[model samples]
Target: MTSDPQQDWQRWHERRTAQVSAPHGPLSLTGTYWLADHPDGHIPGVPGVWREEGDAVVLTATTEDGITVDGKPLTGDVRLGADHTPIPESRVATGDRRLVVLRREGLWAVRDFDPEAPTRHVFTGIEATPYDPRWVLPGTFRPYEEPHSVRVENADGRERGLGLSGELAFMLEGAEHTLQVAVEADGSLWAVFADATSGHGSYRFRFLRPAAPAADGSVTVDFNRALLPPCAFAAHFICPLPPPGNTLPFAVAAGERNVLAG
Candidate 1:
């Protein structure tokens, strides 16, 4: 665990690059179809007929649809309870495309991913700043008196509820800053923010996830891994915008700056 930080950072960067370029990665996302938008449950170019079925999405298909469920051709009807399984194990497919069922805030949706997406074909690489220890600093997590939710705009120009469980407060340049944070299922702290650099030198908004808080409700707020939201990769993702008070007055000069196109 004791290797050069620069080398570790380089490896992390390499891994991030590989992850983004992998099949069904961010670039492969072609569409995120909300069920409410398509009452017929037929997503454009997606095989089969999907309809909401009480806490699940029901699929009806035929061999001519060329759809597969668990590597077997699908026909008739199969009640899918939202691809609760990992993406790799999602039950519906067409050729190399994965049809992932989803439920968000009680609304159902489907995500379509194809390895041959145009975005994936033309992607150059993610432009990331080299990691510096200074960009990583200690911070404290203070939970709210009670959980609160705020309506924030999404990358898709839609407003949705962004849940907040606490605040991560830290000092970057002799100035204390705070960001509303969500406690991930895995216990990590995730923040969505924007700054002076946004919309000019960097993506309009980015995400930062500090490591999980320690027993003392403290954590390390690392901006080196700040990320462009998935919508930055494709236009279909509904990534949430920054919550209130999460925008630091100071510029954050680290992490992926912008999308690089060929």
Candidate 2:
């Protein structure tokens, strides 16, 4: 560790603070209305009546509903597929609030994000400890003999299957720890993990994604960029739990620690 990691850490911390407090950041989320919970298609404060019909959502709206579809007042009915784009590009909107249609395990839900939300108003910043290069260590990616899925409980207490593509192993303290990771579409790694500090200092769990590994399975297992999941910002999101044995026994004091006042 260098003598003045504070300067670099300050810069990184400032960036994180700006990100979480941004116009449509995590704190902007106000509600998550699951279609399963409302079979009749009425989600309070949200315009349009929605129903899950097969693989798509059947939305019925009148101009009086005060709903905007594709930036124009909507009337009549429309079928909407899953919203996979960023929140800004979602098909539904009401002023600054982005209504995103979601599909998970065939179950549909809608997420509402508003810049004027109370959480966003009270958001300080993400509390993160300084970055230390020593915490960023080289690692090895070992692909699973075969990809597998495990039934894990989500933040909303729903058990759903979480797909695991491979495992990344690295030495944190003295013992080697392995984290089940997913290979994203861009070939990068994605991991959800917890440490001793979880539930005590920061979110109950955080996310980490070291850069893509080499062909030979060499990679950097940097924990300095660990992130809080969306569920940490709002209770409506159904974020999956860590896979079996994904938790580290040691306290990881790096990366984003808590939500601070920006």
Candidate 3:
């Protein structure tokens, strides 16, 4: 732990604000075009003809389309897999707009990120409570014997498989609560959760990512560091909602509340 936890939180919050307000951040996301929905390979606003192949998306475009791949003008066909780089550095670009190829649950989709998106322009800041020591609680992570998947409804109103790795148990306001969590590749824990404040005082749902647990499974569950999900910044994000049992019964008046717009 830092000697000055409040100062550390202030720095973290500032960094998060800069990240979300970046040119190609979540606020700049304009749309997610599922390839299956547009069989003709033509998405309404996105250039190029996109068709899903065995494991890649074949993009057919011409000089008139003004699409570039890896900084070179693409005049023919190019096969692209899911983009793993930052949106601004994605392989496909039509001017300042990035066309990110994404594959989820064997379904192919394209995300359009435009720096000039209206949502980005209107984003003022994130509404967050000041760092409070009381919001920091000791927690424990219990890994499942085997990981499991649950079908959860996403912000886009689509059902998708949400992978769960374990349970994160913590205490709040004299009550014990547990949330289903997903373990990241680096061993950190991520959770999607909501409280009584959701939709009224905060966003509908928020994300909490605790650092890797200790050898004894001890960790810090800091609500002061809670984050508004991507869907809070843009409607196009398909952020999964809080799963059953993940919602807390009491209000959590900490962390990020919502996005402030002009």
Candidate 4:
């Protein structure tokens, strides 16, 4: 690894911009159609009839409607489970658009991803502060006695469960702070947080993903790698808000601030 933190941060920022502006990235999301809101199985701008049946979503489409499933034209009904694959690999397609099925808290929704989405077409870049070493600090992870779930509001204005597995404690500006975090599948710790810069000098909230703690629970809290949540790029994403106690009282002037003006 490079000893220069600024170099590393620049590389990270470059990769983030590439990912965000990719054809099937968050910027490509054009719509999130909740099945319950359309009882008749008809979604605006979508060609198929989608209905929630038990634990799966059934999509009925005829070839004349021009919908394809798994790369072949669809002429009958298909039962689709949640789209666990990547956006480009989603089974349902209409020309260059992908239909991703998802379930959250027993609610079924279909997300439409189009390569030609206006947001993606006009994406400028991410606004961020140059990396400063001062934002890096030593930390310790303390796992909860048991996993806990908290009810939090999502970006879409709905409440949902936010699972937390541990607390990350660190010292900044001579005071100790703690943030609730979730353990990702890869063992990293993910935290949603907002500081004094939120909604003023920075995005309303940002995410910090720290490497897994060592055997002694030692880790690094690096705010220079903070990220804008998915909702910052697209309105259709239902990203969860920062959980209680995760908000820092100080201004975090590093990392990404917002999407650059397009």
Report the lDDT tens digits of candidate 1 across residue range 83-130. Answer: 777565678889888999888888899999899999998999989888
Q: Can you list the residue pairs that collide in candidate 4?
A: none
The residue-by-residue lDDT of candidate 2 on 1-262, one tens digit each, is 3466666657766777777677777778888788989988999988889999988998899878777878888899988998888787888987788888988888888989898988888776677877778788889999899988999999989899988999999986677889999888888998989999999888899989888899999999877778888777767678898989888888888998777544
Compose the digit string of candidate 3's lDDT tens values, residues 198-232: 99989989999999999999999999999999999
Model 1 residue runs over 4 Å out of place are none
Top-lDDT candidate index: 3
Please, what is the TM-score per model?
Answer: 0.96, 0.93, 0.98, 0.98
Which residue pairs collide in model 3, if any? none
Task: Go through the candidates in order and give the clash count of each.
Answer: 0, 4, 0, 0
- Scored by lDDT, model 2 comes in at 0.84
Give the CA lDDT, 0 to 100, for residue 131 in model 4.
Answer: 89
Candidate 2's TM-score = 0.93
**How does model 1 score by TM-score?**
0.96
Off by over 4 Å in 4: none
**Residue 91: error of model 2 in Å?**
1.1
Each prediction's Cα lDDT score? 0.86, 0.84, 0.95, 0.93
Report the number of backbone clashes for model 3.
Answer: 0
Give the worst 10-residue stretch by lDDT in candidate 3.
170-179
Q: Kindly indicate the candidate among 1 and 3 with the higher TM-score.
A: 3
